[model samples]
Target: MITPMAIERTFVRTRKLATLLAGATLAASTTLVAGAAPASAAGPCGSSYSRVGVYAISRGDGTRTGTLEVYYSSSARKNCALTYGYGAYANTRSWKRVTISRADGSQEDTDANYYTYYAGPVYVSAPGACIDVAGTVPDWVTRELNNVHCG
Candidate 1:
Protein backbone atom coordinates (compact mmCIF):
# COMPACT_ATOMS: atom_id res chain seq x y z
CA MET A 1 0.00 0.00 0.00
CA ILE A 2 2.58 2.65 -0.97
CA THR A 3 1.30 6.14 -1.71
CA PRO A 4 2.88 8.69 -4.12
CA MET A 5 3.13 11.21 -1.26
CA ALA A 6 5.18 8.73 0.81
CA ILE A 7 7.61 8.17 -2.10
CA GLU A 8 8.07 11.90 -2.58
CA ARG A 9 8.88 12.43 1.11
CA THR A 10 11.43 9.60 1.05
CA PHE A 11 13.15 11.03 -1.98
CA VAL A 12 13.37 14.47 -0.41
CA ARG A 13 14.88 13.08 2.78
CA THR A 14 17.43 11.03 0.80
CA ARG A 15 18.51 14.09 -1.16
CA LYS A 16 18.95 16.15 2.01
CA LEU A 17 21.08 13.46 3.58
CA ALA A 18 23.25 13.24 0.50
CA THR A 19 23.76 16.98 0.49
CA LEU A 20 24.78 16.94 4.13
CA LEU A 21 27.29 14.20 3.48
CA ALA A 22 28.77 16.07 0.56
CA GLY A 23 29.22 19.26 2.57
CA ALA A 24 30.94 17.34 5.35
CA THR A 25 33.34 15.74 2.88
CA LEU A 26 34.20 19.13 1.38
CA ALA A 27 34.90 20.67 4.76
CA ALA A 28 37.12 17.76 5.76
CA SER A 29 39.09 18.03 2.55
CA THR A 30 39.60 21.74 3.06
CA THR A 31 41.01 21.15 6.52
CA LEU A 32 43.41 18.55 5.16
CA VAL A 33 44.62 20.87 2.43
CA ALA A 34 45.35 23.71 4.83
CA GLY A 35 47.25 21.44 7.17
CA ALA A 36 49.34 19.75 4.49
CA ALA A 37 51.73 22.64 4.00
CA PRO A 38 55.15 22.52 5.65
CA ALA A 39 56.17 25.44 7.83
CA SER A 40 59.27 26.29 5.80
CA ALA A 41 57.62 26.40 2.39
CA ALA A 42 58.05 30.19 2.06
CA GLY A 43 61.61 30.79 3.18
CA PRO A 44 62.62 34.35 2.36
CA CYS A 45 66.30 34.45 3.39
CA GLY A 46 67.57 32.61 0.35
CA SER A 47 68.77 28.99 0.18
CA SER A 48 71.50 29.50 2.74
CA TYR A 49 69.10 29.75 5.65
CA SER A 50 66.89 26.87 6.78
CA ARG A 51 63.39 27.85 7.70
CA VAL A 52 62.55 26.87 11.26
CA GLY A 53 59.13 28.36 11.95
CA VAL A 54 56.33 30.49 10.55
CA TYR A 55 53.67 32.59 12.26
CA ALA A 56 50.59 33.69 10.39
CA ILE A 57 48.57 36.79 11.08
CA SER A 58 44.98 37.20 9.94
CA ARG A 59 43.05 40.35 9.33
CA GLY A 60 39.58 41.35 10.54
CA ASP A 61 38.05 39.36 7.69
CA GLY A 62 39.70 36.18 9.02
CA THR A 63 42.00 35.92 6.06
CA ARG A 64 45.68 35.27 6.58
CA THR A 65 47.42 38.25 5.03
CA GLY A 66 50.85 38.29 6.63
CA THR A 67 53.56 35.93 7.77
CA LEU A 68 56.60 36.03 10.07
CA GLU A 69 59.30 33.59 9.14
CA VAL A 70 62.09 32.33 11.39
CA TYR A 71 65.23 30.96 9.85
CA TYR A 72 68.48 29.54 11.10
CA SER A 73 71.72 29.67 9.18
CA SER A 74 73.64 26.75 10.60
CA SER A 75 76.75 27.66 8.69
CA ALA A 76 76.69 31.18 10.07
CA ARG A 77 75.47 30.20 13.56
CA LYS A 78 72.77 32.83 13.62
CA ASN A 79 68.99 33.11 13.78
CA CYS A 80 67.05 35.34 11.40
CA ALA A 81 63.49 36.46 10.84
CA LEU A 82 61.50 38.10 8.09
CA THR A 83 58.03 39.60 7.71
CA TYR A 84 55.82 40.12 4.70
CA GLY A 85 52.24 40.81 3.69
CA TYR A 86 50.10 39.30 0.96
CA GLY A 87 46.87 39.84 -0.93
CA ALA A 88 45.63 43.42 -1.19
CA TYR A 89 48.03 44.45 1.53
CA ALA A 90 50.97 43.52 -0.59
CA ASN A 91 52.89 46.43 -2.16
CA THR A 92 51.11 48.79 0.21
CA ARG A 93 52.83 50.66 3.00
CA SER A 94 53.06 48.10 5.77
CA TRP A 95 54.83 48.06 9.12
CA LYS A 96 56.04 44.94 10.87
CA ARG A 97 57.95 44.19 14.05
CA VAL A 98 59.98 41.06 14.70
CA THR A 99 61.66 40.13 17.98
CA ILE A 100 63.99 37.20 18.44
CA SER A 101 65.05 36.31 21.97
CA ARG A 102 67.70 34.00 23.25
CA ALA A 103 67.82 32.01 26.48
CA ASP A 104 70.60 34.23 27.79
CA GLY A 105 68.28 37.29 27.94
CA SER A 106 69.72 38.74 24.75
CA GLN A 107 67.36 39.76 22.01
CA GLU A 108 67.25 41.53 18.66
CA ASP A 109 64.23 43.51 17.56
CA THR A 110 63.54 45.02 14.18
CA ASP A 111 60.78 47.36 13.15
CA ALA A 112 60.68 47.47 9.40
CA ASN A 113 58.54 48.76 6.56
CA TYR A 114 57.59 47.39 3.17
CA TYR A 115 57.17 49.95 0.47
CA THR A 116 56.84 46.99 -1.87
CA TYR A 117 56.30 43.52 -0.41
CA TYR A 118 58.61 42.37 2.40
CA ALA A 119 61.17 43.31 5.02
CA GLY A 120 64.17 41.80 6.74
CA PRO A 121 66.45 38.94 7.13
CA VAL A 122 66.87 40.61 10.55
CA TYR A 123 69.45 38.76 12.57
CA VAL A 124 69.69 37.79 16.21
CA SER A 125 73.05 36.65 17.53
CA ALA A 126 71.62 33.64 19.34
CA PRO A 127 73.89 30.64 19.64
CA GLY A 128 73.19 27.32 21.32
CA ALA A 129 69.98 28.54 22.87
CA CYS A 130 66.30 28.04 22.19
CA ILE A 131 64.94 31.03 20.29
CA ASP A 132 61.52 32.67 20.53
CA VAL A 133 60.00 34.94 17.91
CA ALA A 134 57.03 37.27 18.08
CA GLY A 135 55.76 39.81 15.58
CA THR A 136 52.95 42.09 14.47
CA VAL A 137 51.66 43.94 11.41
CA PRO A 138 50.25 47.31 12.38
CA ASP A 139 48.10 49.62 10.29
CA TRP A 140 44.41 49.94 9.38
CA VAL A 141 44.43 46.15 9.12
CA THR A 142 46.29 44.70 12.09
CA ARG A 143 47.45 41.22 13.05
CA GLU A 144 49.82 39.61 15.54
CA LEU A 145 51.22 36.28 16.72
CA ASN A 146 53.50 35.66 19.70
CA ASN A 147 55.64 33.23 21.68
CA VAL A 148 56.73 31.04 18.79
CA HIS A 149 59.73 28.92 19.73
CA CYS A 150 61.99 28.47 16.71
CA GLY A 151 65.00 26.49 17.73
Candidate 2:
Protein backbone atom coordinates (compact mmCIF):
# COMPACT_ATOMS: atom_id res chain seq x y z
CA MET A 1 0.00 0.00 0.00
CA ILE A 2 1.28 3.51 -0.87
CA THR A 3 1.89 5.96 1.95
CA PRO A 4 0.32 9.43 2.09
CA MET A 5 3.75 11.03 1.66
CA ALA A 6 4.27 9.12 -1.62
CA ILE A 7 0.89 10.35 -2.97
CA GLU A 8 1.72 13.94 -2.03
CA ARG A 9 5.04 13.76 -3.90
CA THR A 10 3.35 12.41 -7.01
CA PHE A 11 0.78 15.19 -6.96
CA VAL A 12 3.49 17.81 -6.67
CA ARG A 13 5.36 16.33 -9.62
CA THR A 14 2.22 16.29 -11.72
CA ARG A 15 1.51 19.91 -10.95
CA LYS A 16 5.04 20.91 -11.90
CA LEU A 17 4.79 19.03 -15.17
CA ALA A 18 1.54 20.72 -16.03
CA THR A 19 3.00 24.14 -15.39
CA LEU A 20 6.01 23.40 -17.58
CA LEU A 21 3.80 22.17 -20.38
CA ALA A 22 1.68 25.28 -20.21
CA GLY A 23 4.73 27.53 -20.40
CA ALA A 24 6.16 25.63 -23.33
CA THR A 25 2.88 25.80 -25.24
CA LEU A 26 2.67 29.51 -24.75
CA ALA A 27 6.22 29.99 -26.01
CA ALA A 28 5.65 27.87 -29.09
CA SER A 29 2.47 29.69 -30.04
CA THR A 30 4.18 33.02 -29.70
CA THR A 31 7.02 31.88 -31.94
CA LEU A 32 4.64 30.67 -34.61
CA VAL A 33 2.66 33.89 -34.61
CA ALA A 34 5.82 35.97 -34.89
CA GLY A 35 7.23 33.86 -37.69
CA ALA A 36 4.08 33.77 -39.82
CA ALA A 37 4.87 36.90 -41.81
CA PRO A 38 6.11 36.18 -45.30
CA ALA A 39 9.57 37.38 -46.16
CA SER A 40 9.72 40.21 -48.66
CA ALA A 41 12.38 40.72 -51.30
CA ALA A 42 12.15 44.50 -51.21
CA GLY A 43 10.85 44.95 -47.66
CA PRO A 44 7.65 46.90 -46.95
CA CYS A 45 8.97 50.22 -48.20
CA GLY A 46 10.82 49.01 -51.31
CA SER A 47 14.34 48.15 -52.48
CA SER A 48 15.57 51.71 -52.41
CA TYR A 49 14.59 52.44 -48.81
CA SER A 50 16.21 51.48 -45.51
CA ARG A 51 14.19 51.22 -42.33
CA VAL A 52 14.97 54.02 -39.90
CA GLY A 53 12.36 53.80 -37.19
CA VAL A 54 9.46 51.78 -35.81
CA TYR A 55 6.69 52.74 -33.36
CA ALA A 56 4.06 50.53 -31.83
CA ILE A 57 0.31 51.11 -31.93
CA SER A 58 -1.46 49.69 -28.91
CA ARG A 59 -4.92 49.39 -27.46
CA GLY A 60 -6.04 50.98 -24.19
CA ASP A 61 -5.12 47.80 -22.39
CA GLY A 62 -1.61 47.86 -23.87
CA THR A 63 -2.22 45.20 -26.46
CA ARG A 64 -0.08 45.82 -29.50
CA THR A 65 -2.22 46.05 -32.62
CA GLY A 66 0.14 47.47 -35.21
CA THR A 67 3.38 49.32 -35.92
CA LEU A 68 4.39 52.51 -37.64
CA GLU A 69 7.51 52.06 -39.73
CA VAL A 70 9.68 54.73 -41.22
CA TYR A 71 12.20 54.19 -43.99
CA TYR A 72 14.69 56.49 -45.55
CA SER A 73 16.33 56.57 -48.94
CA SER A 74 19.52 58.53 -48.74
CA SER A 75 20.08 58.52 -52.46
CA ALA A 76 16.65 59.99 -53.10
CA ARG A 77 16.59 62.24 -50.02
CA LYS A 78 13.18 60.84 -49.15
CA ASN A 79 11.43 59.26 -46.20
CA CYS A 80 8.63 56.70 -46.40
CA ALA A 81 6.13 55.69 -43.75
CA LEU A 82 3.74 52.77 -43.35
CA THR A 83 1.32 51.36 -40.79
CA TYR A 84 1.29 47.56 -40.55
CA GLY A 85 -1.31 45.53 -38.74
CA TYR A 86 -0.16 42.80 -36.37
CA GLY A 87 -1.34 39.40 -35.08
CA ALA A 88 -5.13 39.07 -35.27
CA TYR A 89 -5.39 42.22 -37.34
CA ALA A 90 -3.03 41.03 -40.04
CA ASN A 91 -4.64 40.17 -43.37
CA THR A 92 -7.92 41.59 -42.09
CA ARG A 93 -9.52 44.58 -43.74
CA SER A 94 -9.32 47.53 -41.36
CA TRP A 95 -8.93 51.25 -41.31
CA LYS A 96 -5.24 52.14 -41.63
CA ARG A 97 -3.39 55.35 -42.25
CA VAL A 98 0.12 56.75 -42.65
CA THR A 99 1.24 60.30 -43.06
CA ILE A 100 4.55 62.07 -43.58
CA SER A 101 5.27 65.77 -43.54
CA ARG A 102 8.32 67.94 -43.76
CA ALA A 103 9.15 70.15 -40.81
CA ASP A 104 9.20 73.21 -43.00
CA GLY A 105 5.52 72.67 -43.80
CA SER A 106 6.34 72.38 -47.45
CA GLN A 107 5.05 68.87 -48.20
CA GLU A 108 2.63 66.47 -46.59
CA ASP A 109 1.50 63.09 -47.85
CA THR A 110 -1.14 60.83 -46.38
CA ASP A 111 -2.62 57.44 -47.20
CA ALA A 112 -5.80 56.38 -45.41
CA ASN A 113 -8.19 53.58 -46.24
CA TYR A 114 -9.38 50.11 -45.35
CA TYR A 115 -6.47 47.81 -45.99
CA THR A 116 -5.85 44.16 -45.39
CA TYR A 117 -2.27 44.48 -44.19
CA TYR A 118 -0.87 47.98 -44.25
CA ALA A 119 -1.60 51.64 -44.79
CA GLY A 120 1.10 53.18 -46.89
CA PRO A 121 4.41 53.86 -48.20
CA VAL A 122 3.79 57.60 -48.18
CA TYR A 123 6.94 59.56 -48.96
CA VAL A 124 8.30 63.02 -48.27
CA SER A 125 11.44 64.46 -49.73
CA ALA A 126 12.88 66.32 -46.77
CA PRO A 127 16.56 66.26 -47.67
CA GLY A 128 18.37 67.96 -44.79
CA ALA A 129 15.27 68.93 -42.87
CA CYS A 130 13.43 67.14 -40.09
CA ILE A 131 10.26 65.19 -40.78
CA ASP A 132 7.06 64.27 -38.94
CA VAL A 133 5.28 60.97 -39.27
CA ALA A 134 2.03 59.43 -38.10
CA GLY A 135 0.12 56.16 -38.40
CA THR A 136 -3.23 54.74 -37.33
CA VAL A 137 -4.96 51.38 -37.05
CA PRO A 138 -8.63 50.95 -36.22
CA ASP A 139 -9.40 50.28 -32.54
CA TRP A 140 -5.78 50.94 -31.70
CA VAL A 141 -3.79 54.00 -30.72
CA THR A 142 -2.76 56.43 -33.38
CA ARG A 143 0.99 57.10 -33.04
CA GLU A 144 2.89 60.08 -34.24
CA LEU A 145 6.47 61.31 -34.42
CA ASN A 146 7.16 64.98 -34.79
CA ASN A 147 10.26 66.80 -36.00
CA VAL A 148 12.26 63.62 -36.14
CA HIS A 149 14.91 62.04 -38.30
CA CYS A 150 16.72 65.26 -38.97
CA GLY A 151 19.57 65.16 -41.45
Candidate 3:
Protein backbone atom coordinates (compact mmCIF):
# COMPACT_ATOMS: atom_id res chain seq x y z
CA MET A 1 0.00 0.00 0.00
CA ILE A 2 1.20 3.56 -0.72
CA THR A 3 0.66 6.44 1.65
CA PRO A 4 -0.18 10.00 0.57
CA MET A 5 3.29 11.30 1.51
CA ALA A 6 4.94 8.47 -0.38
CA ILE A 7 2.72 9.08 -3.36
CA GLU A 8 3.55 12.75 -3.32
CA ARG A 9 7.25 11.97 -3.29
CA THR A 10 6.82 9.63 -6.20
CA PHE A 11 4.95 12.28 -8.12
CA VAL A 12 7.67 14.81 -7.51
CA ARG A 13 10.38 12.41 -8.59
CA THR A 14 8.44 11.45 -11.65
CA ARG A 15 7.93 15.08 -12.62
CA LYS A 16 11.65 15.80 -12.22
CA LEU A 17 12.56 12.81 -14.35
CA ALA A 18 10.12 13.89 -17.00
CA THR A 19 11.58 17.35 -17.07
CA LEU A 20 15.05 15.92 -17.38
CA LEU A 21 14.02 13.70 -20.24
CA ALA A 22 12.37 16.61 -22.02
CA GLY A 23 15.52 18.70 -21.73
CA ALA A 24 17.64 15.87 -23.05
CA THR A 25 15.32 15.37 -25.98
CA LEU A 26 15.32 19.06 -26.84
CA ALA A 27 19.11 19.30 -26.70
CA ALA A 28 19.54 16.20 -28.83
CA SER A 29 17.17 17.49 -31.45
CA THR A 30 18.62 21.01 -31.62
CA THR A 31 22.24 19.85 -31.86
CA LEU A 32 21.91 19.26 -35.58
CA VAL A 33 20.16 22.60 -36.10
CA ALA A 34 22.28 25.56 -37.20
CA GLY A 35 21.67 29.31 -37.06
CA ALA A 36 22.08 31.54 -40.14
CA ALA A 37 24.97 33.55 -38.70
CA PRO A 38 28.06 32.07 -37.06
CA ALA A 39 29.22 33.43 -33.72
CA SER A 40 32.92 33.07 -32.86
CA ALA A 41 35.50 30.57 -33.98
CA ALA A 42 37.91 31.70 -31.26
CA GLY A 43 38.11 32.82 -27.64
CA PRO A 44 36.63 31.06 -24.62
CA CYS A 45 33.23 32.12 -23.24
CA GLY A 46 33.90 34.92 -20.82
CA SER A 47 32.43 38.07 -19.27
CA SER A 48 33.34 40.20 -22.28
CA TYR A 49 32.26 37.81 -25.02
CA SER A 50 34.01 38.40 -28.31
CA ARG A 51 30.57 38.43 -30.04
CA VAL A 52 32.35 38.24 -33.43
CA GLY A 53 35.46 36.30 -34.24
CA VAL A 54 36.40 32.84 -35.25
CA TYR A 55 40.05 31.83 -35.30
CA ALA A 56 40.96 28.74 -37.31
CA ILE A 57 43.36 25.94 -36.43
CA SER A 58 44.18 23.35 -39.07
CA ARG A 59 45.67 19.90 -38.78
CA GLY A 60 48.07 18.38 -41.31
CA ASP A 61 45.47 15.76 -42.12
CA GLY A 62 42.23 16.70 -43.83
CA THR A 63 40.59 17.74 -40.58
CA ARG A 64 40.00 20.80 -38.36
CA THR A 65 38.81 21.74 -34.87
CA GLY A 66 37.27 24.76 -33.11
CA THR A 67 35.99 26.01 -29.76
CA LEU A 68 33.13 28.39 -28.88
CA GLU A 69 32.13 30.49 -25.91
CA VAL A 70 28.86 32.08 -24.81
CA TYR A 71 27.53 33.79 -21.72
CA TYR A 72 24.40 33.99 -19.53
CA SER A 73 23.59 36.79 -17.11
CA SER A 74 21.07 36.72 -14.31
CA SER A 75 18.72 39.58 -13.42
CA ALA A 76 21.02 40.93 -10.73
CA ARG A 77 23.94 40.72 -13.15
CA LYS A 78 25.74 38.68 -10.50
CA ASN A 79 25.17 35.10 -11.51
CA CYS A 80 26.65 34.10 -14.85
CA ALA A 81 27.29 30.92 -16.74
CA LEU A 82 29.94 30.53 -19.41
CA THR A 83 29.22 27.76 -21.88
CA TYR A 84 31.88 26.39 -24.20
CA GLY A 85 32.34 23.51 -26.65
CA TYR A 86 34.98 21.46 -28.48
CA GLY A 87 34.06 19.25 -31.45
CA ALA A 88 35.67 18.11 -34.74
CA TYR A 89 35.30 18.39 -38.50
CA ALA A 90 35.86 15.49 -40.89
CA ASN A 91 36.66 17.85 -43.79
CA THR A 92 39.15 20.56 -42.94
CA ARG A 93 37.82 22.90 -45.59
CA SER A 94 34.20 22.56 -44.60
CA TRP A 95 32.98 23.02 -41.04
CA LYS A 96 30.54 21.11 -38.88
CA ARG A 97 28.90 23.75 -36.71
CA VAL A 98 26.41 24.04 -33.81
CA THR A 99 24.22 27.10 -33.53
CA ILE A 100 21.52 28.47 -31.28
CA SER A 101 18.10 27.05 -31.90
CA ARG A 102 14.85 28.96 -32.06
CA ALA A 103 12.72 29.41 -28.95
CA ASP A 104 10.51 26.68 -30.25
CA GLY A 105 13.50 24.35 -30.15
CA SER A 106 15.50 25.87 -27.33
CA GLN A 107 17.33 23.27 -25.22
CA GLU A 108 17.27 25.14 -21.92
CA ASP A 109 14.37 26.86 -20.23
CA THR A 110 13.27 30.08 -21.92
CA ASP A 111 13.50 32.11 -18.70
CA ALA A 112 16.95 30.77 -17.82
CA ASN A 113 19.89 32.56 -19.41
CA TYR A 114 22.10 30.43 -21.70
CA TYR A 115 24.02 30.27 -24.94
CA THR A 116 24.20 27.69 -27.72
CA TYR A 117 27.50 26.72 -29.35
CA TYR A 118 29.36 23.99 -31.28
CA ALA A 119 33.00 23.09 -31.94
CA GLY A 120 35.29 20.44 -33.45
CA PRO A 121 38.82 19.13 -33.19
CA VAL A 122 41.39 19.50 -36.00
CA TYR A 123 44.30 17.83 -34.31
CA VAL A 124 45.42 15.80 -31.35
CA SER A 125 45.74 17.28 -27.87
CA ALA A 126 48.88 18.37 -26.02
CA PRO A 127 48.42 18.51 -22.26
CA GLY A 128 46.00 21.39 -21.63
CA ALA A 129 45.66 22.25 -25.33
CA CYS A 130 44.32 20.56 -28.43
CA ILE A 131 46.01 20.92 -31.81
CA ASP A 132 44.53 23.49 -34.20
CA VAL A 133 42.20 24.48 -31.40
CA ALA A 134 40.89 27.99 -30.86
CA GLY A 135 39.37 29.32 -27.64
CA THR A 136 35.77 30.58 -27.06
CA VAL A 137 33.57 33.53 -28.00
CA PRO A 138 32.27 35.99 -25.46
CA ASP A 139 28.50 36.51 -25.55
CA TRP A 140 28.75 40.26 -25.06
CA VAL A 141 30.55 40.64 -28.38
CA THR A 142 28.08 39.07 -30.78
CA ARG A 143 25.40 40.37 -33.12
CA GLU A 144 22.32 38.42 -34.16
CA LEU A 145 23.57 36.23 -36.96
CA ASN A 146 20.30 34.42 -37.38
CA ASN A 147 16.67 35.25 -36.83
CA VAL A 148 16.32 32.09 -34.78
CA HIS A 149 19.28 32.05 -32.43
CA CYS A 150 19.95 31.03 -28.81
CA GLY A 151 21.27 33.55 -26.29
Best by TM-score: 2
lDDT (C-alpha, whole model) for all candidates: 0.69, 0.88, 0.35
Against the hidden reference, what TM-scores do the models get?
0.56, 0.69, 0.23
lDDT of 3 by residue, 1-151 (tens): 9899999999999999999999999887777555433464432333333333343333345232433323332222211122232343222322233233332333221111223443321111122211121232332222222221122
What tens digits encode model 2's per-residue C-alpha lDDT throughout 104-144? 76699999999998999899999889999988887446888
- Compare candidates 2 and 3 on lDDT and give the better one: 2
Best candidate (score: lDDT): 2
Cα RMSDs of all predictions?
Answer: 9.1, 7.7, 19.1
Error of 2 at 64 (Å): 1.1
Using TM-score as the yardstick, the better of models 1 and 3 is 1
- Per-prediction backbone clash count: 0, 0, 19
What TM-score does prediction 2 earn? 0.69
